[model samples]
Target: MDTRALSVFLSVAETLNFSRSSELLHMSVSAVSRTIQRLEEELGQSLLERDNRRVRLTGAGQEFRTYARHSLDEWQRLRRKLGSDEELAGEVSLYCSVTATYSVLAPILETFRATHPAVEINMHTGDQADGIARVLEGRDDIAVSGRPSQLPQRLRFLPLLESPLVFCAPSADCAVREMVQTVDVSRADFDWKLVPFIVPERGVTKDMLDTWFNNRGVRPRIYAQVAGHEAIVAMVSLGLGVGIAPRLVIEASGMADSISVIAAPRDLGPLTVGLCSLGQRLASPPVKSLWDVAEQTYPRAI
Candidate 1:
């Protein structure tokens, strides 16, 4: 069977839409259908159940999808292994937030490119909160993420840098800012409940924030839960509510003048920012190379 057909099948299987898969594969819808038809004919089983309403994978198709992924992975591994030692070449898919793309990944990418010029870096930038989920879902090979409170057994983390998670409020005289200023930050009896809190929509940052609030017995008056720290900073700058974000994000944000860091209690720990990927994926040459370069670029903080 042609590997191109397998690739097309995988794309269609993932989207469950023939038109979308055709667009992704740069093939006409009829051509895409014919390729799948040929594949199914050779395999002697119906792989997909399609009708006007929807498209779905049959049990055979589901099993074939897994096989296709493994086959493609193995083929890429073999190609990389056979490449010239002086010029390593393959594709490496990476996911990271916009801030990280510029702030953290830029330097690492520069170094990696210098070392492995032939390796294609297929990078996707999105909300930092979704980095881990994207990696777990096999959308990407690696992701830049914060160390979650409970690290999963199937994943491996390589610590890069430490950035303290800090509370932020509008520099302007807003309700939360006024309330924050009224009470001494050094005092233990400060009424944290009065302050409205903005937080990440989901992910480790939210997990950390939840833990911090629960530990203090403070039922925070949440104002908003946004997808990214950049949005949180934007909201906080507008005096919508106080928010929590890593210090790295705050520094990278151009709105430093519009927002002020709250003197959060010492218990709010710093985020251990780093590279992470599935333990199984690290065996791939391109993935392992990037992982090693990142480790060398930013050795684990003592």
Candidate 2:
């Protein structure tokens, strides 16, 4: 019945850490635990399970998480509807990578804020790999992400920019460059497998690399599989290996002095980076307003 408790429960459910939830809520760990206990007692259901090692949601907890998200969204929607006539007002949680936060998200957020001054923008920045999952989990209203080969049916993507997916090599002499230069195999004999690659550990970047290599009938020799495009830049800058990342990431990395874009194979094409959100989320006023601004500001650069 207590919306505050429900909010606390959702935070804990998302993080799966009592201490983290407490910190996020600006409450003591004991307070967070008590709030969850009270909610569970009210519902007559065991919502979560905890051990010394970690915490996890029980089956009931998963069901309640969905309920809590909708309940909070509806509550906020009602408040906005009743509270304001001249201005639309509500919180919009957005997620993006560090690069996107400055590059793609900056202008979009600025425009959104100017239009809806009463609305709060709760922005979370992290690796691009986690962007869509954040939206799908109901944690973020929207996220900046690259369009995947097969987008989920529940989600919608609006293209913001097109950046070529290019292979990057160390600007200085490196083993990867040396190998590429020395391995003068004929077009028929060219073995991409001979070159070492530093690639993203997950997400569309990894998927793209997998597809590119598979289509070419060669498995790249991975020197490292890292989490972020920035990390790829760092690794490639050190001559650790060649890497593939969007031109946007490279341009924003500030490490362009240390890396150079390699001529990516023709099969590997440009990436379309943009905003992503659940179709359901767009129905919310704050989310819809921001989505409108995004559509108007960046009209499908692809």
Candidate 3:
């Protein structure tokens, strides 16, 4: 388990000479001997043959040599990787609600890819809570989530994008298209109507949506409720009732041609979104790279 001892064991095994291994590691010969002795004692077998002139491995030594060599090489690789954590050069895994992937994160990802050309990204799609849970459980390096639940002390949150909620309906014969009429905020130039809706099941953004609708004193038919934005976009494209989603969702769905924006009497208001990860996961280079991209892209803008 002691990597230094493993390193010493591997070195001695490589040259089959204690003196050369000690010289290579810049350690005293006695120290090298004691490390091997301790290793043999731990494994309950003698691992080296010692005479005055020549050194060789005992049968037990040969078997452990393979494991010891591999383990030492792996540990050294880990050290080198951790030491170079300042620059991005590995795969960054992330999770987000389908909408965030298209709306909130597309530009950030594009610029990030351009800047860190050697880095690769793996993205998973899920609901806000699932995204949060994925990152916390080590399934992802970071997650873009609209809601940060009562996270335990081991997790941290990073605020990212804030965009107004918007409703989208099929530009075709969607039922709610007739209800959308643009109004000048100060002048009240057009009319808006209440109808059934598609929304994320009760989370931060959902609560914001509810409050916005309630304050306007309009009752949504409260028909369909689902968890992901893509489904909402898909259903809306099929002429399913109205869907209230974050503005980014509409843009990212790539179905804009199939859907039209439904103007509200007032901006439903910007909902705050952000990134999350386990606090201890910050040391990973991939996480650091993705976090850097997110921070530079969405820095608490006004």
lDDT of 2 by residue, 113-193 (tens): 898998877678888999999888777889999889999999999998888888778888866778765544324357767
**Candidate 1, 1-302: lDDT as tens digits:** 36788888877876789998798778999999999999899899999999999999998998897688677768777765788355666567798988898888887899999998988786778887788887776667899999998878888988889888888889998777898866764355667678888889898889988887677776777878899999999999999988888888988999999989877557777888888899888877778899999888886552
TM-score of 1: 0.84
In terms of lDDT, model 2 sits at 0.84
Better of 1 and 3 by lDDT: 1
User: What are the TM-scores, per candidate, against the unseen true structure?
Assistant: 0.84, 0.87, 0.58
lDDT at 93, model 1: 76
The most accurate candidate by lDDT is 2
Task: Give per-model CA RMSD.
Answer: 3.2, 2.8, 14.6
**Stretches of model 1 off by over 4 angstroms after superposition:** 8-37, 44-65, 79-86, 185-187, 300-302
Model 3, span 127-185: residue lDDT tens? 77577666654456688876443666877778876666767777886446655433332
Which candidate do you rate higher for lDDT, 2 or 3? Answer: 2
Model 1 CA lDDT for position 172? 95
* Pairs of colliding residues, candidate 1: none
Q: What do the candidate models score in CA lDDT, each in turn? A: 0.83, 0.84, 0.70
